[model samples]
Target chain A: MRAIWTVAIASLCAAGLATPASAQAPAQRLPSAIIMYPNILADGVFETRIEMVNLSGRTQDVKCHFLSPPTCNGTDFFIRLTPNQPISWLASRGTLGTGNFFVNAPPFNGEGSLKCFVVPDEHGIDHQNAIQGRSITFGPDGYTESIGAIGIQRLTPGEFSTTLELDGDTYAQCPDNYHFTFVASEPGDPATESELILSTCDEDLENLISKTTVVQFQIINEFEQLLSAATSVRCYDRKVLSEINSVFTRDTLGTPTGQAIVRGVQGAVIAVIVDKFVTPAGAPAVAANEPALSRGRPARIRIP
Target chain B: MSGSRLRGVAVAVALALACGTMPARAVEVDQVDWAAVLRALGIALDSWRLSPFPRMTPTPTIPVPTATPTRTHTPTRTNTPTHTATRTQTFTPTRMPTEPASGQLSFDPSTGIAPAQRLASALLIFPYVVHSGSKDTRLTLINMSNRNIGVNCFFVKDAGPVYGCLEVGFRINLTPLQPFSWFAGQGTNNPLTFTAAPPFDGVGELKCAVDPDLPDLEAHNVLQGRATVFDEDEGNTVAYGAVGFQRLSPGHFPGVVPLDGFTYDQCPERLHFQVLTRQTGSNSSIVLTPCQQDLLTQVPTSTTVQMQIVNEFEQVFSSATSFTCHSVKSFSSFSTLSRSTLGTDTAHLVLRGVHSPLIGLVIDQFQGGPDNSTHTAANDPYLEGGKPSQIIFP
Candidate 1:
């Protein structure tokens, strides 16, 4: 009976239903993309799986970097994909035990995020335009879902900058102004966190080439009132994990549903994911980010 | 006794028994037959002696006790938004949780849908429980297109009309990659519209209709976006995601199509959802919430929607008829929905809408300590074919 259903799903997957694990956005050419497993548990209870596919016309070089919060937990690995080849990984536990291990994002107690992009290197094939991917996380009491990886199109000339600089200034000049918006705090209660995903959107960097950028911030209350702060960002693909209240209340901004205006001294490509985490009962935790293009799409402007 | 003597004695006893009367003393000598019995038992005694004894009973299934419906419990998150700021984002934050843990997610903000000739529309369906002890649905909707688009939203309450269709709906416009979200309980949308709907003290669904405008002179790519839905209560928490439907329509550009070429009239031929219904002093159950998207258009009163529940043994248990638009039903072990026994097991939730194409969600959960609760929601299977439609804006 189990075999029957297993085979049924397998065949159906081949025919239709599971056709696109991530309802891929239509594109003429494959582009660089970022895949996140977001929440993972390997502490014996919950588990997370990442499915990656080379949806390009040629073989590709897949570069994956695992980022954990609290203490800048970072690791990197490479994947070689023939055209249309697919691969799956056990979050940070690596490629299912063969040990090419690289993720330590979870089981440390809470949640973490990961970023992946396809780029050519001396060791692997040249860039595969874009990689279609999905992340599934499940455990005993929570829900499991396979979500499509968010895609970051290949950066065009000046589309994204690593050093905050003037819009038309040379790469060496200081960024007139660059900041990412995030809603980290909520209202009423003060336990929920407004987590942030600070990804390095610069996919075409030199091999092992890493750079650092200074960041400043204009924290705002729910009233859109300005507050204070900032941090140093390493383009090595890392996460900025912080509580909304601590970062946005009387100590920071003023209330739960406040905003953070993250300003970079230099220009760089970055994507911010503001996830709201809460466990009113204190045991099981869940996050819900108000559906808003508040973070990913940064406004274009010139800062003095 | 000697081996020869024992055999001879056994033969004598057998002959006496066959002759007519076998003495009890004859059976007392039966112990001597142990050696012969071993030889007669034949087949691989060596292997049998080495092998672990197999148990006689089948796997013991965990029995799930029916949950005494509770009306009040601490929810993971609430919908009632406080006045943190005179003004907040479209999707406002209602409460702060117990703790703030670090987190991250690499989203494909633009990867779900492709350009299609059809005036394609995507359907975003989710379930919510807003009663005293109820759960709420928190979700995010994104517009992946570079051009402006509009979305029509509908709130389908879990109960029938006597409870008032409970559907409070409205529309919103998106500029390029705009995202909008809110808690269904307190209210969503600008004027706090959903707050006006009846108190949906039960489970129900939300449907958002993507672009309903058909293609103009120039062929254009349709809108696309990513969705994340979280089902949480103070003790229980579950989260999953569904990308907007991608239409693999056949034509010159046979790759991807939305809204089946943007055709206004469309419905899935069949839908299948795998669910886990755990029950007990330990809280487990498979929740199947099916809503008929075309309810408002029903004729002569209402339409009958039948859902057949099939267990692992191929046994089918069906539900009572559903006339109204939405229904949130639960089937677990030892419950009225079971065939014989109700323990920890898996089954398929099957049903179809008579006149309207249906949308369904399946959640499996168990209530426990420390961690409070655990649950998982599986993916929806569009077995027959994709059956979501574009919305007609009011």
Candidate 2:
């Protein structure tokens, strides 16, 4: 009788008729927020820096668009990035990893209509495949042929970095409020197939699941001072490193850290640091292989 | 000789007297004794004179009745009388009167109408009126007053029938001193014409009429009409009119039965209206009727609105600004809006912005389809549509 029951269960599984209780349950979605930091340059221009992180185990990709105040057009101050693209920088101990992207910033046009987006990566494209399970398929002759896995990192903690320069003289001439938005997503696969022990199949299955994050900051001359005195660092994912650990290893090279930090300005220099690593004591840490520290070089940005 | 003879006679008489003697002789002897007594008396008198002086005493002469009358006859003296005459008289004169001077006459000065007021009277249907098709459809203005008058006209939209219209400019003559009676249309065809009215006698009312078909000689429906009457002699009288027409056919009617031109005169200022029947459909005739009033009280001033867009990664940017302005005579209005880019992210993105004086304003409408490809999906993932924001005038 037990053997007969086992056969029945296997038949049910093979026919794609069986479903686990967990599948019917609703999935809890995570909340995300974005912060914008603006730095004023000497040439009367402005540079903006952002950091985006995933707070949930699900990985996410974020896109940002900036509009001048009076008219919020998509092309105004817009930036697109893949899952691995860094949104800001990180500082750990005495070491700092500056962001690589450069954004041109003008004075706020006075409309106060800026926005951004964040998308989840359930397939591990933003991180490595280690945190998620990998699958391998063999040919009919028994020779191993293909290997694949969901590439998204469930980043409980992550970090991103980038810089923008704003025209200070222009800002002085027209002081205005800069509005911004940040969106988050947790995409899932819609074409996922039930596994058969002897069958091999490859499918492209990804859907967009997203949320929005919003923040506002005034453009003033003393913006850098406000950023330095901030107590809690604003980020989309405060524990972004944990989410990255689910899909990629600590030593993974070129993995993008997605985090966002927003700072207000009154016309001066502003710096943002996004760190994804944590120490043994559970404190934030900078990556050990950062280029600035490894090459023993000083990183300085001058705007004239 | 007489004395000797007398002496001889006396001697003879004395001798004869002595002889005759006695009394008679005494007399003759007295004569003789007189001489001797006289001598003796003379000697005694001389002796007596020595004692004084008793001077000669003369005896009184006798009475001789002498000739008084003889002296009077000889007196015949000539007497001459002299008389002088004096005369007295008076005189008088006359006078006259004078006169005074004279002076000239004067009247009240005329002021040009405001561009807004003119536009309010001219372009009654603004953006709704198709700007194309009839290039001959220009603007016309008329002043009903005998005295020369000046005015301006304009075009506007958005604020409904009352206040949204804006001014384009004024229509002043090149020579300022010369009183302008009429203005030609802007284009060669000159669809619209403006003229001053003839002066009325003994009345304070002036009628201004605008004829759209004047130069074209084509009859058209009047779009707007206004009239002004000076209640008092020193008051103002203004009149204005606008012309437009709705056709029964969709296409141009080369030769259709023309309708009688509508006439609106002696109307008051500050009147606004919309046409009740604007379009002509199948089996339906277009008609012009007065619509509602007080739709919009005042025109809008400078103001603005804002909007935002976001991507998969939480990054943001922005743009903000205002519209353009135009003026005609006494009215001014605005159009066009603009702004700059703002955000911390530095990546390629697209944005679009727009504004319309007719429909107010709308911001940021995402176009195209959702980008779900693996490459683009890996990049951006958000969509927004419709008017993302609004701006209102203050």
Candidate 3:
């Protein structure tokens, strides 16, 4: 009788508590109305290929902005997707469609980030949560890697406003914390190194005002020994892991793997990591992974 | 004692033991092969209903205190050495051994589900893996918590005659924060070469699960992994993060684990991908594996995928294809996906398993003009609308 009761109670708990948190909130892996690609590089040797799709059953109009570093200025473009249309373009060459569907100018060079959103139409932006995108960076030596664009869906769609709220009420909130894991690069091993790219969630494209925030990092090695580091990111920034702190190197940690917990001190940020590894014979390989998002906070994206 | 009173006492004692001595107990029985025993029982009752067994069995859990404070750090302007001072603020691992250093540890205590790919405890799937003369895939796995974790992995062969679905199983112990990596051809060096079984040139999927033998720790979603495929001669490489599913329920894990958002998170119902078609002188191939598997019985499962293709002009076309356990579908094979038919260089594709859920990546190879001969890039498609599925583990 006791066993039967425990089993029965456990079954009820399993049925009631099975709904995932993602059902209530948008996840990075799913399609959304807005998407952001934080790492876009086109520096001669490497170029970025942007791909996008409309997952809805109706036509959708999308507006995109490319923000490059140093100044992090914005360049705007327009694209019209008929129902489930898909599109692709090289960041360096830009894209020109048949009619008004095109980019005004060459929107990319060096390195930066790309953000896109569904424009308000008669159908409203509510049904426009079908935009899915990816950015693939490829080099001449067959070195290529890709990152899924972070997708944000509107929680409550209303009258069109320049200020897009990512507060879990208007849209999906920005993650307050990001968990990054990587293998420590060996000291003198020209083969292994990782690059970290970070983009702030707060932006003002209408005014070209980039949000600069200080990011705090708490790192732990295989031994559970903790280390800390900090850096300031304006708009978008990229840096080698060891440049922020030498502890990321295997020689310093005395371990092959380490985990870094990152948080923005002032606001929120999204991050991606690209790793390059080569064998002893000089064969090279590269891969990219996005940090896991935990917690959530409000952020605003102001656009004209 | 009455049944209800006895049950309450059992819960209290279980929580006390879990909070106090979980790590020590995990190490004490590290050598046991409990999965093998379960595999034997699963084969004997292959057709029997096992869902009720997992829920009824009592599993110990260490309840995390509700009001754990979120840690805040001082923002620094530059990369100065003083930034390292925050290391001294480390919180000891006592109250919550499995809690990550993040702000909120939101997880289902009954099901043990974490967000997809974040705190994945149940399974990690590398949908595409290749090993041959010109190419090799390297796998990297990491443990994210403060305690050690044991993992069991399987290499399911995708190409062969009768034994195409053959599985080669192996186990490894991951120290806290440890990152393990090895070439698919070379396998792990420490435990000898545990590469793919018969037929040296093989391609398929790699699935890793938290070792069920570790008492009270079978479903802590603290593992994360990634895979990189690179060319040996040309150095062409592409990498992707492994798809992870966190365990939803904690107890005696059943052989047939349902991915019905109750026992585990549901598998994605549809996958969205965009790629450059043959019109642009580029080729794209998608490697896919079904979410439903019978590793215990070594039986393969097949699912048909319905694809909706949309060109740049908003023109839509539909097609369907079927495959067994694993398959690599090329865009050129389908007329609807070609540049000549679609009249566009690139197209957007949405794929759904007719009867089940699927996971995979799209790999694109471009032909460069001058100094560069060729290059490849790969990325995971966007997933939408999850559906219930099941995995029969060995």
Candidate 4:
């Protein structure tokens, strides 16, 4: 009876392969072979809940790297997902009961970026576009904001390598600039606060060397008035918009809503924006969104 | 003995084909016989694919562009914007470049459409979950291109005496780089006048198209938008980007647009939602809007949608729902989506519109969090399969 069931399942699998996997178009907002969450927190009163789902009909092996800033050191792990398997874990707790892989949590009071790529199979078949992911960050004020994982699909089917190129060759190139808008932070009334988290796409994980890039911020108010600010980011940085420059506030911009265009001078970076505000009913609310991406220069990631 | 041999052959063929499509490293072939069969079958399959069979399209070998990384900037220098300060010099961001550099496709040529969320186009669709009254939805529309653009937006309710197809149309003019936002209930009156109609407590969709009357512009794709829906009492908020359909051919503006790939990109056939199964303190709901809608005729679109829930163990349970114009289907009632049935806390959902291509949003809520508060998050459903659909304007 078991053998009979196995034959039946095999027949179904063979029949389903009539339609090629390449026929499926990539959804920029969908799953990719490689996905990244720019900001994950595991500090006091904060935890990041990560959810990843395999969208393909086959099993996938994933290699994940958690990189914290300052030194930009990485903690590596592996996950094995069955066909269409969905898994969720807290960044602070790691995947203890998920049955995929056992990994220790990153250091306490540390926040950084998490990147995972589908490992090519033994026959060297690349399933670079098979997973979709999202991360929800729980904050100290009892607020939670969810951001979809930024997925980068392989431009071509090639053998896996330790040196991943983000240059429209091996994978889709990282964006040159990011455009995002937010309501200005004001002191009185329903005060609003926004945080921008940025992670560099160019890194040498093998040597644990931190790559610093100067980022330029262009601010445009609702009235079309423009001002500029500059900052340096090494590996990863998360900061309140006002801290970079007070011009981000409504008192300085002279408008309630403003748009910021950020560009990295030496390398490319991916980012997520979080905005917290109070509703008319005086209840606290938080909203998060990924910035619009513009393709530009190439960046490289060297894994150990 | 022959029957047993035939069964062996069948199993070998099945495993080979399935393994061919899967990432090889993930598969563990413990038996020597299966491994040998897979290797032999893989070789045969590669040869067959390399043949000139029209149906069996092999993965084309795209030569990796050897373009030396040309962008070299000094570590201390700051990069400047390339454009001057002019109205037409507004900054527009492209998630994925539709036009590949030097004809080398950044994505696979076989995949018809690139995965994108913030699409640049003359038309934008906010598929669902816009509310009023106790709950409010704030909409932000930005003219991404340089130069002035005229905007016409239609807000349609999803439930009512008329089957909730009623619409309120409004117009606004946005300068280059200008963004306009407003609450659905409060409404805006800067040359546009309309408000959410009574019952005052319902959800709907907002469709915004570029108006070519004042600017007399061509079909230059340059509109982008985002929407945030929040509950006043619960203080829960969810935000998402709008779906954009870019016009393909160059011509004067027309009232009716056919999304036949020639005029504009077709809508997706299936939407994949990453959802948490109905567990102790979690719930998921999806809002679907049909791709084919006639706002000019005020005729509602009816579509029968097929939904499949794929559990963690790769078990699939299926269901179907039919609705007119728009529908919000909750997983609370689907026993197959329950944690007990799925045997996991999360599952993958695939929705296909039987009659029309569709677009939608997935809203998730988790209760009993740290402070005993309910947390809500909304995301755009990943899309698959492209099918032609149409939109009629007034």
Candidate 5:
């Protein structure tokens, strides 16, 4: 009887250990940083492109939501992209989320939405697979898109980045400030942990990432000059994630994590710089000395 | 003695006869001559006869015839001398006096009695009645005759129809050469007087032109007579006539009053006569009577009429009152109100009346107030009692 009793106590202990305390206590959510490039472009046919990267340790499908933030309180953000641009998609791990957006750019009426999706493989690794992704586009009609399941590469654990090449020659120049927002979500369920990422340069290997980042481009002197560059980036841990959700949900019934990018040219400075650059170039001078290297060789000299 | 004493009785007849015969004889010598005488006597007796003295015998007396013839011849010579002396004495004058010759008379048989020439005639039109208490009368005399004549004006209370023998008093003296003119005089010394009732029965006459006290014949020759009667019981008197009186109105005598200053009361209703008697005819005719209208014709109108108002002191009073008038047909009636104050507090409120382009009336009252006072009662204090409280007119 004593041996049988002891065995029963052990079984109880095993069963108790087998069941989860809070069902794995939802995975910790990572922070996100947004990078934005602001510029004044010449008029005519033009093209604009934006590449998103995931810098989180886990592969992240970054969804970009374009909006007029409170800091840019009075502006209206409306961008046009090629193929009517899908606003929401899934990015595979370790890759850039490239979009070729046209800048004929329909008129923007204020607010828009972007959503991303990431689905993990059987081994719990995030993948850019078609069956496990989801996305939708939103804005005014004809300017709104719902491109479901766009392919996106997932970022590796350490550093991730991308570049945006905007072909400005496609459309007429527009003199106004532009703002962009990017957000990332974990693979699988949208209710799972999500993060927002930010960067200044078009490549990960070139620039550093912080809690927040802002990139401003001034098209002055027919050349783009960086004016005010500032941003805010955040580092997230499991404790911080849990604390945020607990405090937010307990107080307001939801967890809200946001990233804001404020970038624009100082119009006064740009006008002065552009005027200096666009001035006509003088004629080249004739060479004072001729080289004797070859029987008929041309020499080059600098204009005084 | 008869025959020498009776022939002596004879004896002495015989003796005497003897004597006688002797003487006769002596005479007989003479007798012889006697016989011649007897012859002559006889011739004489044929021419004449002689009467006997005492003897009774006719033939016996014949002897004496011779004697008678001789006596007659002597006496005839004596009578002729006496007749011549008497004729001479009767033809001589004794008393001779010195005196001027009498004037001669001319005869113009062709002309009849000369037309009666008007001597001096005067008309006394009294009481023009310019305004109440204001009187203006006139005495106008015309010397139609060429000769100068003196005139004296008189007033008679009860002059009968014949002004002659009427008791009159002297008022004015006018020279013969000059026409008589009388205007209203100032002060209480007016020449006329006013009475309540009409038919004043006042008669005026031009008495002796020469004063009775002055006896110079030259002066008397220039004298003339005139008489007038106030007719219609009006307030005026006029003198006009020849030597006698003519009734202006039967038993109607007008009253008379003196006019010191010209009053506007006598002005026409629509028109006013601004001329003084000195400037106009003494007997001017007006189309419209003073203060009255004439339906026949319009009076000459004037915008403003100049008038003189004199006070008791003979001072002219002009600043006391102002006048305004309105027209009625050809005439106008005027109303007078007090003027703004004169310089001093002691103002002369005496003003008879004003003459405008309208009728004339007396200025009964005048009042004054301060400059700032504009209320009717305050400014025109005379109206406080309803009837003008002050009297400015005569």
Candidate 6:
């Protein structure tokens, strides 16, 4: 099949719909990238399928690791993609279950996005950002929401982590800090979870995901006062953080209005995605009369 | 939005297939190998270009034959080509996914139904009935940017005959990351009072233009949005995404900004889609939205789009119309197509604009069974976006 395509190309240049390689402008090269999907769900029957494509000219050896343990990639898998090649899988599990296909990732009970930093396979130097990806949530309710991934230029060695080699000759780098902000949610409002992914960049097993950092969180209410005791996530193996002493839910008999801050230590940064889970079963039916409650609700598309 | 980029990928497939640069079909099949055609569709999706920045589900790929086939019949079974030196070519099951006389559709992962990406210029294709019961499209536009943005939003309704005018649409300023939500057909209660913008709320797509007033013309990729469609029956709720196409800088084009509009870097000249329905048991349809040529131009531009639907038998049933900016056309119910010769199972729909470009038009199948059980499977139309650089309106 490929051989025939090659001959056809030669004939096409003579026929002319497409400009010959020499005549056409040079194609854009993929850049060194820090591709992140803010939210990945693998809870119960729900799932998050991720699709990644490599449009670069050469093969790209990219490493992927989750911020926490029993990570979705199964201890961070490395994949090599040729130009224009696309590889997709379920983030929770490395691959899909039996014929229940159509899903790239399994139902990962957790919620947070996947973070990938693009670098040359052989050479550690950052490569052009050429990889693009998208993540979709398959809620048991049957509604499919396609939230594609976003690629931000990888942080320079100076902006985030230093070029550090933790295990073997393989490289390990981490962002020094990350801050997440979202409008406050009230009680009965679908509880909101601020999931931060801090993956193991190290590629060795003897190390067994040993790098650790203190992620201190501060909850500040609309009144600008501390709502909860100063709490910190103490761990070396937590990939995603969805509970800060049940911070996602409102305390006290009434709903509270405030924001929380999670400050990571130097050489300990991660991507944060805040999901407003549609009110859970048996939760309070929201009081619809007050217009104030609707202010910070997550924005969604409608059929107009 | 990735619609233009999706179109870009589609164009590559069609071009490669057209010029014989790539496989006319990936594997030679005795019949239309639905699975083989479906798998190759994602082959050209460059990870980096998968609807850059803010688009998803690029366009319904232009089917390119992956093989210089021993047979020459089917191509909707195609996409961008991949030239591999040595590879394992899996022979998927020849039988198509099982489909009953009616009720449901269990689709393949790559069915082109993934929610599409959002862009500065987008269209939310869905069904809306606001007459006796409550059926309205609640449109939401979010300015992902932290900065305030000025947007011109239109809620167009299908009048059965033609698309209503942009006369009722409104222009509002959105605050940093603010969301402008409204109930179409039914007036919204947001920045404005109880007023439903014109093409006054029937059932159709929504068009949003960023930076309506321009010299800077800076409002192309800054907006991302979606639409929650409401149907007559209470349980009829399907979340449809608005696919995006970018607004290129005037500089991309020499003087004039040209009437047809500068074709996108990844735009395709044509597009194709597939449709299905089992008798009247399924209500299958495809909605076609027209990408604006020079959207802001007060001088209305027009283009003729020839849309044809061909069934399994190779019989053709088509419709052609000239539309200005902000108009949409829909081909409803393939099960009962205009040409009965095409039969009842599946139909191939092709959309070609004489001058402008077609967006990611859609085809959805909806129905209610004997037990009053309602099932809906709507996929973003499989669009093959292929066109010259400019999708000029006039």
Put down candidate 2 lDDT per residue, B1-394, tens digits, no spaces: 6999999986676555444433344465434565554444555556677754453243211111133232332221100000001000000000000000010101111111111111112122211111221111112222211122233232332333354433332332111111122111122221222322222121111111222322221122112222111112111111112221122112222221222111111111111110011111101111111111111232333322122222223233333333322111100111111111212221212122233111111101111112210100001111111121111111
Candidate 6 Cα misplacement greater than 4 A, ranges? A1-39, A49-67, A70-133, A143-145, A151-186, A189-304, B1-135, B142-150, B162-167, B175-178, B189-200, B211-214, B217-224, B230-287, B292-355, B361-394
Assess the local accuracy of residue B350 in candidate 6 as a C-alpha lDDT between 0 and 100. 50
lDDT (10s digit) by residue, model 5, range B1-394: 6777875564343433333333333554532444444444455445444545333454454454444444444432332233223311111110000000110101111111111111111222121222113222222333222244333333322233343222223433332233332222211222221101111123221222232223332333232222221212221222222221111111111112111111100111111111111111111111111111111232211233332222111123332223221211111121111112111111111112223212221111111112211110000000000000110111
lDDT of 3 at A7: 56
Model 4: what is its DockQ? 0.17
**Each candidate's fnat, in order?**
0.09, 0.00, 0.39, 0.30, 0.00, 0.00
Query: What is the per-residue lDDT of model 1 for residues A1-304, given as tens digits with 9 covering 90 to 100?
Result: 5446545644543443222121111111112333433334344465655656544335556565554444434555667654333455555355431222322222233344555555543211113233555455555544343333443333211233222221111111111222222334444453444444443333223234344556565554433345666566564333434532256533454433333445455544343443445533343344322111212222121111
Candidate 3 error regions (>4 Å):
A1-26, A99-106, A122-126, A187-191, B1-121, B146-148, B175-177, B189-201, B211-219, B248-252, B279-281
The 0-to-1 C-alpha lDDT of every candidate, in the order given, reads: 0.38, 0.20, 0.68, 0.68, 0.20, 0.38
lDDT of predicted model 3? 0.68
Query: What are the clash counts of all predictions, listed in order?
Result: 56, 116, 3, 9, 77, 69
Q: lDDT tens digits, residues A1-304, model 2?
A: 5446545645544433222111000000011222222211111121111233222223334434332211223322333333222233210111122232332223332211123333323322122111111111111111111111101111121222222111110000111211111111122231101110100011011111112222222111100111111211121112232232322111221111111122223221112112122211232211110000000011111111
The weakest ten consecutive residues by lDDT in model 6 chain A span A288-297
Q: Which lDDT tens digits does candidate 1 get at residues B336-371?
A: 344234221334444555555455444444332235
Top TM-score prediction, candidate number: 4
Candidate 2 chain B, run of 10 with poorest lDDT: B89-98
Looking at candidate 3, what is the lDDT of residue B231?
A: 80
Shift of residue B277 alpha carbon in model 5, Å: 41
lDDT of 6 by residue, B193-227 (tens): 22234424444455555553333323334455545
Best by DockQ: 3
> TM-scores for chain A, candidates in order?
0.49, 0.20, 0.86, 0.85, 0.19, 0.51
